[model samples]
Target: MTALLAAWCLCCSLAFASSYPLIKSKPNDTGSNLLHEGHNNTGMADRCSDRGFNAITLDDKGVMYYFRDQYVWKGYIGPAELINDTWPEVPVPVDAAFRIHHRNKPEVHERMFLFKGNKAWAYYENKLEPGYPKLITDVFPGVPGDLDSALECPAGECKSDSVLFFKGKSVYTYDLSDPSAVKERQWPLVQNCTAAVRWLGKHYCFQDTMFTRFNPVTGEVHPGYPLDTRDYFISCPGRGHGHETRRNATLMSIKNRCSNRSFEAFTSDDSGKTYGFRGGWYFRMDSKRDGWHAWSIGSTWKGLKGTVDAAFNWENKMYFIQGSQVTIFLSDQIYSMVQGYPKPLQDELGMQQVDAAFTCPHSSDLYIIKGNTLSLVDLKNTPRVPGQESSIIHSNVDSAMCNSQGVHIFTGASFHRYKDPNELLQAKELPEARNIAAEFLDCTQ
Candidate 1:
């Protein structure tokens, strides 16, 4: 009886420890009193209203806005004046959002993308454009939906039209320069990142009441952050704040149950060798080998460290993808990385990090798979312009390899094949080719 009571007490303490304090100000605390509750009374809005806001983003005009439930509160730069009570007719609850400065040569305009679940709405001056709230896959192509946070990241080689979206530990960058290419970066795992914003050139990520400032260029957290958010934005109490307290509590409880998540950061090469890596730690493995051989990524792999998110083989050469950077390796050696090699993938093939890739043995045509779409890369052709082709493969591909037998694709635990009839007919004629095909299947399966 005593042990049971003690366990109960400890569990209660842990629950209490995870709870964030409600840091709302009184009714007449600050800002203009033009606040009004949204008319849309969905269950999601109730929970979001109780939590105050899910995210806060800054516009190109330097105006900051807080998004909660279906309502939006626009504020100015200094003194934090409320531009409008419930500004912008936000149709639904927002999961993650970012503002974009769409510029195509002579024409330039401000655009906002609001994401909710798998759908996203493109807004211009608070008005939804024609055929909006489309599937995020349709708009962003390779980016996965249901993002936790997003920000307009305009730094480094990324064009002014690029935006970064976060889902768990992975960061997906989509540039308007070429909508087909989607860059990815594996970041340290963070939980419940409620909001993110850029102020004074540095990015600040928020998890409930705490905030962390990150350097956009270095991708490192700046010193003096994870501080109380009250130090930055003033909390103001308004309508719909009190009515959804219970609903907020329920959502928080649900989050506690479903929020425990773990993801892998690894890649594989064409030779059936899987490499497990995270940050600086790395390990290489082969089915023929006994076990994983752990090694220091920086020392062993040289320029190709744990930053590699995807890898593939084409014409005896290996391609490594890290964000927009691509590193090449010759089939013969693994000691030193090729110099002047970590160039942008966009420059070569006009596509970003691919999900899966395989080269056709007969034609030497490289198939680059990103999301559910596929692009054929004919290396023989100069001045590559990526053209899309119809494919039966789905998104979230695991790996792909091609040999004398056929093209094998893996998505999760399932395996698929796209056999070229011409190659099969030709292979039957040559005895050596048949043996090679059998060996290739043995290595892959």
Candidate 2:
């Protein structure tokens, strides 16, 4: 099995290299065309220096579109255009948004509504559409008048039968199982419904109350086991089960109350019913002057059924640069955990700060970013037995995306793809990847 796996990995590496056709490099000045007429400022030039002026996305049909924020300076909706591959200048509205949030499946048609004061606005397709961001009475029949508190709400379909919406203190559920589509509200059930995941036909919610599982259709909380609530706010949940589920679903909770208190990170098998506490870790500022920091944690988070094995840590503090290297907190320290044991398996990485991280459909491969650079890690490489070091995939670029089939990294404006074991082995050759795989090191430097 070991030899076969090694051979399979080798072929995958070659295939990864061959997936993209090499193109000639153009002068870095190509991005300047998209700049505003009077923006001759060097600061603006610096922003487009290393960064490509436009972002690209491949649709289900494999058609690539280039997007740019025309209103980036005005603090308004940035319009994106479907620039032709041949004519990159002709812009069209592919989508528009005041801000964009990245996720594994950030469909253009899907909308995220944020409550601002008494009103709400829907952020979708890269623009804020004119409409009530809250659940309308038309969508949820017989909503209470008192519930008209203009709260920010984001709704998603957990499964065919389960639809969930995150409000302030409550997460409401709508059951599509019935022909009539009855809406059932479960408020104040999970203290903070910041992040949620659906597994085994059940929905898990994480917030101030730790984690809890609910029947997607009935909105009933699970009976046995509740999540560890030692901390008031559990940030991420379901770390190792990303592809199998959604969101890392990894839960981070405050363990104590020191100004810089240690925290615990864990994953749940019984939906959110029970969580296996990994260990304690802390977040620290990366540099005193930069005010950037990194998060470091122990290998306490695990996978469902405790079958997949992996370990995780942040590689660097989040930072961004425009004209000059400006230190900005792009993301919190990252935490990773994997599936399998003894040998490398699969893994998932979660951003401690930003809402962007890559999750494979059902595979253990995970990726996260700091600024523009991307890093890959595998949970399968770690031993299931205690006290073992796991392997991680690393790259020099910014940002990465992955599915069950393979992983892709975004360097400059282009993307590079890699297959598993081979990708893992190739990653092992690089210095950054090797450093990340070494014993847990603090990135707060």
Candidate 3:
């Protein structure tokens, strides 16, 4: 059986958000920072924090459009501006919008479709196409009017280039290549998609102030999602109530310098839920959790305490390596720490502390990483023991994961995708496929 999970949740600027309003943890108190903290304070007031958007779309030139009641925020870093001031031909308060940027299709000419009421308008590079304001059905057959949100799922992600039209809890997938292959389904996590946009190569579904990153092909959302849209999408200096945007972080929300994506101990268990550890909090990779985001590690994991150096799952059990010690937990129906499991790492795995570790899909070999070197542990054998350590592809590995897709090794804010375990084991420096900030989390552009 194969597992699917985000390689690692980028240690985001908001991973341990003090802006969350009245929640505290012990992690930042020890004077340790999982990542650096930025100190730049934007003097401007107002937070892109809790406001909702009516429509969201990205242009070919990388400009992001965020609409909310006749106003729009045009880029990642900016204040709200009048919609008419920018796109003169486009109407205000567009219910839904999606871009068509296919190279093969010239008739549409890299245009954008904006929906309002029952009518739809096509804009080529923001210029309204002639004979527009047509019925929604006429523009996008099989799609309903008054959509909650819409975004393009281009080829390679979805089977074919397609558009997702959202309404309440229902999603209508309109295939661009084949009009007859329309599909409709219910996604409970996305109760209301006020806005959604496809940036880089990932898809995001938004509601209120939160957004969830999801796969366009399978509609599988990353676990521990539904994070704040403002933290990742909009740059609001003094966002955490006087705290400014920075490349580092502090304990208190008042001192937060949000926007450095770094994380520790990223792992996925037998149940398929992925967990990302940062400071005193952890983000679970599921969006179905009641409009929630991060959780205190102690509040959920139970009994496993202190700093987590590395983490991985084997035989339906979770292993969290912290400094010289390791904590084991039973990951069955109920998450519980195994008795007498806060043992020394050397006693159990014949090792001290490690940088990162992960078990690949359909294999019994567990890769335990340290620095740029790694040791192998055969899980199918009687006793688990680390073999000779040798050099590997990445250095300062923060986390690792394995799904049917491939083995992902995360370092800093970007990660390398190895087609399989063997491909990763033989590498010196593989090509990085995605950035944790841009692709994994909907945090940066």
Candidate with maximal lDDT: 3
Candidate 3: where is the Cα deviation over 4 Å? 1-52, 57-64, 75-77, 98-113, 117-135, 151-163, 167-178, 181-308, 311-320, 325-352, 355-364, 367-374, 388-445
In candidate 3, what are the lDDT values of residues 295-378, reduced to their tens digit?
446645666555677888888888888889988888643357889989998877777778888886556778888888878988
Cα displacement (Å) at residue 50, model 2: 47
Compare the candidates by TM-score and give the number of the best one: 3
Each prediction's whole-model lDDT (CA): 0.49, 0.28, 0.64
Model 3 worst lDDT window (10 residues): 1-10
Candidate 2 accuracy as TM-score:
0.28
Q: What is the C-alpha local distance difference test score of candidate 1?
A: 0.49
Q: What is the C-alpha RMSD of each candidate to the true structure, in Å?
A: 24.7, 20.1, 10.5
Predictions ranked by TM-score, top down?
A: 3, 1, 2
Candidate 1 lDDT over residue span 249-275, tens digit each: 433322121111111233445444554
Q: What clash pairs does model 1 have? A: none
lDDT, candidate 2, equals 0.28
Query: TM-score for all predictions?
Result: 0.39, 0.28, 0.50
User: Roughly what TM-score does model 3 have, to 2 decimal places?
Assistant: 0.50
